[model samples]
Target: MTMKRYPIAIALAVAGSFAGCWTGGVIQLFSCDDPCYGLDPYECDDPCATCEGECLPPPLLGYDDPILLWTGEAAEEAAVPECPPEAPGLVFDGYGGFEADHVCPECRCTEPSCELPGGLTGSASAACDGTTPTSFDAPAGWSGACTAPAAVGSGELGSLLIQAPTVSGCAPANDAGAAPPELPAPWTVRARGCSGEAGVHTCREPGKMCVAAPVPRPTGFAMCVRYLRPGAPECPAEYPELREIYREFDDTRSCTPCGCGPLEGSACTALVSAYEDEGCSALLGAETVTLAGPKCVAGPELRIESMEARWIKDEPGTCAATGGVAVGEATPKGATFFCCQSDEVIAVP
Candidate 1:
């Protein structure tokens, strides 16, 4: 009685059985980065200026006018890098990565180092508590419009062709009778671009991209001006709340002879080229910054701008954007991320 050969169903049963035995992950969700993996895996949380989980007002830019933005003759008409290439060169999904997977939020132990059969070494990674928790593959089986957290800011996504913001007093008039008044070397990003709930839109071409909201007149910025003039009524910097995210490419991160890749940087420009009632703004990791007002002035428009941040081991939750601005602290109430801090590089002017 028996050569009972049932085919498709038998094959399906065997395949399903083995599928369970085969253990491998198609995606990874990791956080808690090591400098060895790359620079701290989070955008610099400036602007928010939080501490102890409480929100503090953002710092003001320190300069008064464009005239002070440079030194010698150069500073007088301080030039920027030829307004950068129009096409944001190439577009790269500048998402930072997880260092390893065997992650333990308790011990902060990440995935273990990996070596393939021959020699291709690999590592495992996973998500951490405080970070935004991006998955290698967008979370599986997500439902509803609200299922996924939205990007921080608004403004169209992908290859943004933004015009340089125009600063009237910042520029000198054209040679007698030529043009009315020319704009400055390069335009800065807009608060509109960098100021919302959705994250941001960045250039695919990776380099070092950073913009001073309302164009910082100098370093240690204390103000973002609408139009710095001799005697005209003043307008505070468009949006003192700003963000400049710089990232590098794959091969670029291979530098520095370390096991980890090169710490690449990226910059996206949303140059505003309009005048009269048109201004721009962007937000960086400086979670808290001074508001645009009578007393608000930036220290310097130029800064070394580093994105790496160091939060106390115990205060992971404090760094999040939920509790207002936390600068070197651990709590907050009616606002965004509170108590974030970073060191300033230098003043451009």
Candidate 2:
């Protein structure tokens, strides 16, 4: 005969009324199609198994390490390296396009020149201080030779006045004809930097991170290091490394303005003689004096007929040269910091 089976709850309730408390080994309400059915939930390989606790999120892709930067520079004539190709996942992370239009020209000076003392006069005043002076002057083209002029009127030969010499021409020779030297080539040099991809395995090695540059290249280049991020603070928390790289320059380079100083070391002295005759053959009195004098000397009371003068000592002076020093300077435009995992430092170009 066939026996009918009921649900576990109904069968358990009927069995409980007829018998005392039942201790059961196992019970099944229905059969499951799953191969894992009735097994420990932890041992189940089922895709629909209910998990017991909280789930976790996945980690980010790529290396999580900070990126370090490098810089380089080149002259107008030399070749500067381009970003290396051997380092895969490398990027043209930063650029330092360069320019230098400032220049300092050679300093120069012209020879110093001076004029001779020319004005000579006689004064009727006994003090010889050029008061009430009269022309005892030599001829316009006189070259310090002795000459006799018309006899002085009574009392007109009491004193003589001589004028000092002056400076005539002096200056910087460079300013004579040329405009300033042509400014240095604009944007003459250039610079660029590179860094590896974050967490990139290939970028982890030194020198391997960069390689020989390609052709059609610039004049000069260098390998350098910099902070990966631009505009970072003076010392960034992540990158405390310090370095200097230039994108441009601040150039005020120039020669000092040309100039000349006061005259020095010039001197002249002359001898003046008074004569009783027009030919200046007989002298009444004579005095030796310098350009610093309006010197007066006691003259014989006799009527003065003529006068003559001759230079005793003559020496030209010089002017001190001033200015002409090279001034101003050229400096890197901005700063970019660099950080390293160790104490390794990259040389600047």
Candidate 3:
């Protein structure tokens, strides 16, 4: 059988396949006849099939520089670090964990208002039962001063009609810019300093090499990962193991509900009197009534020529307030990952 010859490049690759020591920056092949048996088939006419001692592992892949990271509050701004030559600098990756404080303003109500009694009438029917009625109403906005509205014969005024005051204008008070501002931005961080070397190396087959590893990992870093897509994805062949996660986020924080209560505690009253003369000189009878209006009462048996009404008591009311609190949370967005390579450290000779 005719033997086939392989090229020098192929021979060198095959010769470097077996175990050998790392010197300076290159792999030094040993002759097959040597006790260590480096498996160089071309070194000796007859190649040794086996080695007497354990073989050295190949070199490992490591990043030329360390991966950088920076993080802070969503509202705070942070500065990024410069990268090594020929490598990408710190970039805005995404957001990670988050924190927030949300709140609402207090609520309140304005004071209640009221108007005194107006428009009084008289009836010849006893008990003011709306029979043979006559207009004895005081002028609009009339005070307690004496005035003759109408004259009545002896024993003609049997009853009187008085309408209660008007109550109104109770509303919720305004807050000092109680509404909240717009939502804040998501948490952020800068990372990924540089990458490891690429392409085939001269390291021994099945042997790991030692190179410089980034000193201490960045603070709060889940782990070192190679990024391929915007989201978590399969790691490169160099870094096979990995964990998926996000670097940025979407904020949903907000405030609770708030409002005011019903108005209450308001009241009003007035005193009314009938006089025997138009000048209101001789007092015939008098009574006090509330603003529930159209109140009727029996008149004095004597004749009434005039009448008078004076506001006696008026009480203002207030409303209670409710609900003003903080609530809600934020969600994570923009995915990424953590990946790694070999951890072996080989001593250089």
Candidate 4:
């Protein structure tokens, strides 16, 4: 399924430099510390991807041919300091410089990206570590044999997983000569809203899955898992009918790995010969945010969550005038973009 993200962390006033920015950063590995991400030349297509998870990137920033970086650290790829929906982000002035906020609160990441009738766990992020899932869904049919050789020393570390299908409604036909029905089978990523039907799976990541609790649904809203009969197609035609086109399902694509290259040791392997600007006044220490922002910022009826900006003066207000903001002061207020609380995150001057 094609998913477009709306980076909620992007403020559009400053550039960001950090790990979560999709432009170029770390890769989300499994839930293991000291993860050694393997990059093979021709392993699987793409694995360990987090399309809709904690590292949801803000709309203000994005990735360009992003390569996943690996570390054997048991880090929280899905955890942000304070935001509810912990996602990677960028602080960009849109003039060639940036900062990594690690939180995208403004962008819309809904699958098919049409604002589903739920929370923001369904958003997207560009800065997902290997531990943080980049993309996952039920394999088309588990029809392929993946007994390929381990790519160790071969230059690429790939990822592959196998799970039993979760069927509900119909009892899989095991009769002597029973014919399997031609319907879609049950399968999906471990996301929350995904397992609405017997044949579907769901995500559990904080800001990337179902809300803390399921809300009351209107009349025809669907929510039970359907057990697909054996011998069914992957996805049937005339499905979703525009609302949630089956293609938009969280686990639409299988968790396959894409060969990148041999893994990097620690810190940085290759080094630069000389320095251009000994000191360019670049930022080093990163700013911290709340862990509950994502939870408070999602849903059709959101809130007036935050406000911060840089390079602006009065009328715009800074931390000095606002409170403990910690960003954007020595400029004109009109020269900045601020994030305001509303039904959904709204951008203000």
Candidate 5:
């Protein structure tokens, strides 16, 4: 009974257990055998782990993009750039910038400066205050009268005051024996009778005259002409043809017909050309005439001479034989006719 024996495998397990207990319960069979002791002790099995000193305390956080570590200790901050102070007489353009001078009313911004619009300039009577001047020069070609001196100041910076000029005085006269200065277009000269010993000439109002007459005197002559105005007839007796046309066409007293002048001093040839241009096919029988007359005319022997003439095809039939005294033949009841010749229309014999 004392000769009992264990298996060889059981005997080896008992010996291994004793060795494990001696090494703090670590089994030597699969235990890590690191030559670098205590260096990353937990990383003993990691292939990339090295025994190079202590693990460097994990790179101290944010090593790539370093920032100031605000510890309990105090330190000075980094310096920053300063901006320039604002200047006087300048206003911000609302976008991180400033503009020179104050903006003016109705002002337009031009490069390097601002501009005011052009307008009528004249002097007006106004009392001058302390800041405003009593008098100033009016704009060119303009005149005005002010009881007191007045100044118009600009809204912009360093703007100057403007003064008005007087416009009521008589214009100066020209030199003796010299031709008078020509008036502006549509403004002719007229004689305002005689002023004392000297003859006086003045410009007539624009659009007032229908005909321009020659200057009567050499020095003090002003242009005076007839204008096409209604009421009292100013038709010159020299142009009897125009008067006759006016009588026939101007029943309503409208001045329109008078404009078709045997215009003073114009030739008959020019008048005929003017009438043709005005869509008149014939000149009728007048030295000077207008298109404002009856359209149709009946005659014993009618001849259509104008290139604008066409046969009256009432019902689409050939015109009657070219020449002869035909009664009621070529006459179209409500149609207009014009005398074909350049001369005046003569009464049938």
Candidate 6:
């Protein structure tokens, strides 16, 4: 009976070994190797362990203090050092330096120049004092020199004593100095219109008008007249006659004289005849005259003399008479005749 039991035991062991092999094969076929198994277990690299939260350190600290190393309330507190408080009347001097009295000098931060005080010198000292002092020798204890206690009854002497430099050979000579040599008078070149003659004449100062008046026989004559500036008082004596005509846009516009012309009515006609004798015939003729008001009635007879050697039918009259007409019918007479019709000659009829 013992022999039989031993054989059964061996068979049972064999069957158990086969069952273990089958179980191991089935597990290997269904399960896969973990991709993140041997790698650093920081963030999720394994698809299967993504939702399990098995990763040791999270990718982001998530609201944790950046400067702190530990997580979950174990981080050391980080306190910034406090800066020094600013003092009154003190400011930064822009070079990492500070000054209590921040008022900069005229040349600010630069060494002061050796300029003489204002009331002590005139413009001559400007060129001499435009540099800094290379060597300065002050009296001993000059820092406290003016701050010393005064004598009991002595009046206050001024704080500092300033002395001008002693200059030699700087005296100006009285007789040696002579008035500036007189300058030659300035003259302007002008052309004589009648004979086409050119000559130079003395010119006036600037802003003066060079008026060239018409000479008696087509010659030229020039005179300088001071130009009237704006807002100047009327000077009729200075400009007795119109020396020049200017088209200036100012109050001087009213000062210009009226031009000679054949104006309206009998009064204007008579004025034009007296003032402008040369233009009388054209002005009073029927072709030009159109007397609207009062109808210009003829006046006293006027005698005229012809300057031309020959005369035409409708030639204009000049000199002492105005508007002459021819008497006889259409025939060229050797001599010219005067036409009479009150004062004005109507035509050669």
Winning model by lDDT: 3
TM-score of each: 0.12, 0.40, 0.40, 0.12, 0.11, 0.10
Question: Each candidate: how many clashes?
Answer: 135, 11, 16, 101, 20, 0
Q: Model 2: per-residue lDDT, tens digit, 1-349?
A: 0112234466443222222222253232322234234565434333322222111111122212232233334354345444444223344333344443344554545555434445456666555654566665556755545556545566546655555444455566666345445555444334454433221211222222222222222223222234445574354333344444455556666656655677577665666666677777887677666646445554433345566666666554666665556556556666554433232433221
Q: After superposition, how far is residue 164 of candidate 1 from its true place, in Å?
A: 76
How far residue 28's Cα lies from its native spot in candidate 6, in Å, is 3.9
**Tell me, what's the RMSD of every candidate?**
46.5, 19.2, 13.5, 46.1, 51.2, 54.7
Ranking by TM-score: 2, 3, 1, 4, 5, 6
lDDT of 5 by residue, 1-349 (tens): 0111233244343322222112333332221232223444333232222221111111112111100111111111121111111111111110101112121112111111111111111222121122432222223332122111122332211221121111121111222233322221111111121111110111122211111111221232211112234333432322121110111111111111101111122111101111112233443221211222211212222221111111111121111111111112111112111111111222110
**Alpha-carbon local distance difference test for all models:** 0.19, 0.45, 0.51, 0.19, 0.19, 0.18
Query: What value of lDDT does candidate 2 attain over all alpha carbons?
Result: 0.45
Over 223-326, each residue of candidate 3 has an lDDT whose tens digit, in order, gives 24346545555655545555444665556675544456675776778777878888878988787877565677775554778877777777756667665555
**How does residue 291 of candidate 5 score in lDDT?**
21
Residue range 1-349, candidate 4, lDDT tens digits: 1112226454434333322224224232221121122533222222223223212112122111111111111123242121112212211111101221221112111111011011111112222122542122212332222211111221121221111112112211122133222222222111111211110112323222221111222222222112133332232121211111121212121111111222122111111011112231222111211211211111221111111111111121111111111222111111111111111221110
Where model 4 places Cα greater than 4 Å from the true spot, the runs are 1-44, 47-81, 88-330, 333-349
TM-score: the better of candidates 3 and 5: 3
On a 0 to 1 TM-score scale, where does candidate 6 land against the true structure?
0.10
Tally clashes: model 3: 16
By TM-score, the better pick of 4 and 5 is 4
Model 4 residue 323 CA deviation (Å) reads 28
Instruction: Assess candidate 3 and give its TM-score to the true structure.
Output: 0.40
Give the 10-residue window scoring lowest on summed lDDT in candidate 4: 111-120
- C-alpha displacement of 168 in model 6, angstroms? 27
